[model samples]
Target: MATFTEHYDLIKPGTDDYYDVADFNENMDAIDTQLYQAEQDMAGVSEKIGNPGDEGEDTLFGLLNPGNQPEEKADFYRYSKTEIKKQIQNWKPNLSGSTTFYGKITTFRAEKNGTVYVKWTSSDTANGEFYIYHKAPLSILEAPDQSELGSSIPKGLQQEDFCYYHINYVYSSNKGKPTTFEWVFPVIAGIDYTFMWYASSASSLYLNEFSLGYTDTKEA
Candidate 1:
């Protein structure tokens, strides 16, 4: 008579039965197959679970914080407090332009949607008005119908048909004194904007400096 183990069914010799090499080989073969299958299952799990030091996609270390994740896929990853402070401290002006009243008008446009800053210094003998207008895109306004909308909406308009009057400043400066002015506004990507420096008296209106810049954060 012969008996067997409960789990793997390994052979256990009864008092009357003698040891057999065939039974030993069969048990070893069964154990080898189970070990191979276990190794494969562990490997597949390890790939998804990932190691502690692993970085980037498909790794536990690369997983973003559940509370800090972005709402949109296209949005940038949320940064830590230190990283955000570093970005703000490293903020620099991207674009700049200078022009005098006598020089050609200066225009600015941003490549990305962000906050724009315009700054200038001017010296005047009398009073004058400075204007910064955001030129509207061609698609901003639709063609008007003569039957419904009257003179308020004109037809046959070109791309430069409309502009948003952004900044209107009236200042009185003494002779040989320079006054500085700056404005922060929102800008759309790829739209052109221009500023005008007008003087009530042309005798001594000097635009010393003019600059345009943008930043990702609105605080700029």
Candidate 2:
């Protein structure tokens, strides 16, 4: 009795025999390696397309670290003007325009959307008033951006205006003890800001210890 052999097994040894399991496995591995390399290349292309221009460009996953893990930046930033010991007599004095910069606390930078915190100390005997004004660039103030129309700012502001009141605290409660007030101001990304403080009093309200804080969206 003769047994029947498979048709593929009839091929000569090492003569391009397609039935060789070793050759089949080698080819499969090569194909798999090519597929994997192609996938990697495609992924790199996608990333480049997502973030154009210079390297380390911005992307939808910008909030992630290098390890693909979510990262959170410290939201609180503080700047103190300890040398701001000037006394303001006018009610609407522009501190930013002053030569001393009101103790050099005139400029603050915001890289992303957040809120600004302002704090200062005022010394008044009684019936004195302290004021805080927020100032922006002249370009935005001259035209009054339409986006600022719905803002809570007073309607009395003119077109060529950069000063807007954040708040005013009359020195009636803690007269000689020196009153302190904290104000919160909303901010937008990529905008430079300066704050002006004014005090009105006959006895000369001493202003000092100017400090500013803000919520930041920058990376830690």
Candidate 3:
């Protein structure tokens, strides 16, 4: 009370308590400003972490940028002119739930002809139609279940959720025995990409041999 004059300049014009009245508001305003800034920083980090559809997916972080940009889609699956070959010599079907086919490549190209041809021989099961699908990492490796071909209990070469483009193959009903099948299709906006194959017979399909070749296509 006696020396209130000594601290008057330390106070604000609208209130007597200085810090308790008008000046206190300014202090709170400063704190609120800091809080807002912190929120912005946290949001930036969340954006970087990415929100790939389901959280339980197994992913190579940054491989598929989420919510950022549509991955650069190509008119062709893999670059053309490349020859990729995969060979599975001894594959035990329905052994332990998990089976992986393996092989190698001689040369890889960037662009190719309008069509790609895939060829392979297998002691593949035969009773109904089979499938030749591509393979990639899935959101989760589900317990081996039904293969799309609906063969016997088989492990699915289930790929990640993708917009896949594959042609159909209809074999003769009398087509029995482990044989080889080859077909050529035009490589349109989406085809002839990198993927895998399977046989639709309740038995193990031994991949005797396999090869991938493509014809260079001229841009339309």
Could you tell me every candidate's TM-score relative to the true structure? 0.39, 0.36, 0.33
lDDT of 3 by residue, 12-50 (tens): 344443334555566567667878999999888876665
Q: How many Å off is the CA of 218 in candidate 3?
A: 12
Runs in model 1 lying further than 4 Å from the true structure: 1-104, 136-161, 216-220
* Worst ten in a row by lDDT for model 1: 82-91
| Shift in Å, residue 141, candidate 2 | 13
lDDT: worst 10-residue window of model 3:
101-110
Q: Write the per-residue lDDT of candidate 2 for residues 5-70, one digit (tens) a residue.
A: 263232234544346576556556666787899999999877755642222335434323233333
Higher-scoring candidate on lDDT, 1 or 2: 1
Estimate candidate 2's alpha-carbon lDDT, on a 0 to 1 scale: 0.43
Best by lDDT: 1
Instruction: Please provide, for model 1 over 39-82, each residue's C-alpha lDDT reduced to its tens digit, 9 standing for 90 to 100.
Output: 99999887877764445557554554322344442122221111
When 2 and 3 are scored with TM-score, the better candidate is: 2
lDDT of each: 0.48, 0.43, 0.40
